[model samples]
Target: MSIVKIVEQALKDGYLTSAMEAEVGRICNAASELSIEEYMALDRLMGALLTGEVVVLPRKQFINVMEELVLAEAIAKVAEIEATSEQNLDVGDIAAYALNRLPPLYATTEEGANFQRARAKEELQEFISKQVKEAIAQSLNKPEFFPERQALGTSSKEEVISQVSNLLQAYAPEFEPQNDQGTSSS
Candidate 1:
């Protein structure tokens, strides 16, 4: 007989007394409560991880399969949220954020030096780009007339504005090559 049938027969034969049934229910309830607590802890941990508030050791330094499992669970949560939510969600961004926060899983000899270097490079590029854009805007917003602008045949404010727009579009294609105003390019 199947396990389910055997269990049914035992229960029907009064093998599982009222006390035993009550105890089983209590145990199941306790287990359900414990599982809820475990899930909550995991959710908090994953949020901390994705938000860069927590760190996990790399596989080389500390081989903890639980870390991987937690990450997997976090990813699964994001995926579930994305699938169910009406609004669009960026699962890739969540994955990237979690991965960036976690230590290097494959290469441990370098101690995440390469990852740090890449992030630094990206930050530096962003900073420099911001500075350059701000400088351009400030220069263009000046009231004073510029001989250089005149020489470039863009002495008029309209010409300067157009040039700025063009430069912005080239620097950031998300600005839309055709749209001069700040609006959704998509």
Candidate 2:
């Protein structure tokens, strides 16, 4: 959605989601310049946020204990391999692979998280280790396909600007820039 649309939605709902905030940030960062409408929308959002008219939701209120366990195991194993050799492993990839194969232990409170962590260590350490090892092996054996692919939460500047421009055109067609011929640029 365009910044105006997102702001309108947030105003209507009285809540600004983390995703919405991130999208706005991404668009603002990507754009070389913001339109007058975009600036007004952002200003309104800021005022609403400051006055408590809109609440920004927290990105995550719970934690998965299994992810921490798998990450710790993966880092230790990857460190061992990297220490003795020149090979470097993607710890995030390894952890994600293992996490997908394991059950989640979610906790909303610190005490709950501690209990979940202890329970996992006592009952699932071996399984977590095995999964991490398998993930490492698979990563090692996997060929380097799509080597140019960007990592998560990233995009080319041109791509981001194009997306923002398209959104602006769709929501407010009159905002499009005109050439000397008095026609909008494509």
Candidate 3:
């Protein structure tokens, strides 16, 4: 079978990778007897395949091929920037391409955006935890809430303070205090 047919079949089966595409193009080019019309026709076929209408769960082999293809392209972009005499390489375009070529797991823009949001949430949680710890430490020395605590039980100040800290930690696991050695009290 011709390289074009192989590419078409691989694409239809959802197993085509960028590396395979480039290799197939090279093979097609080597066949000098192919007319301009033939090349253009192949281009059209490839273009149709990229229309995003066809969604399939890609095979593991294809997934591996895609990772290598994207990584190589990203590395090449970095190398090109390094080789250029101009120092102010924006690199934004390459970064965008690399991000767009991420795995099938991040197939849509929403998936990528959601992943970023999750990372931001984790960072926000950490920041809030630090703030809560500081607030708890300062409040530990205060007597403002001691009157209310006495009405509940015969607990001493130390016990009351520990209980308050525990309650705070229960509400926010990230706020769980560190021990003397700076590890979590878990």
lDDT of 3 by residue, 45-134 (tens): 566567753333353321122222233333344445558735322222333344343432222343444454345334543433343333
Angstrom error at residue 31, model 1: 91
Where model 3 places Cα greater than 4 Å from the true spot, the runs are: 35-41, 53-186
Give, for candidate 2, the lowest lDDT window spanning 10 residues: 169-178
How close to the true structure is residue 166 of candidate 2, measured as C-alpha lDDT?
54
**Residue 7 lDDT, candidate 2, scale 0-100:** 100
The digit string of per-residue lDDT tens for model 1 on 1-186 reads 322332343334524334434544555466635455445544554565566554443333322222232233343454465577653332233333444444443323334434443453345434433433343334335565544534245546566447544543443333222244734357
Task: Please give the range of 10 consecutive residues that has the lowest summed lDDT in model 1.
Answer: 62-71
Q: When superposed on Cα atoms, how far off is each prediction in RMSD?
A: 24.5, 18.7, 25.0
CA lDDT scores, all candidates in order: 0.41, 0.80, 0.45
Which candidate number would show the highest TM-score if scored against the true structure? 2
Q: So what's the TM-score on candidate 2?
A: 0.64
Highest lDDT, which number? 2
Tell me the tens digit of each residue's lDDT in model 2 across 88-160. Answer: 7776678789999999999877778778877987899899999999999999999989778664544664564
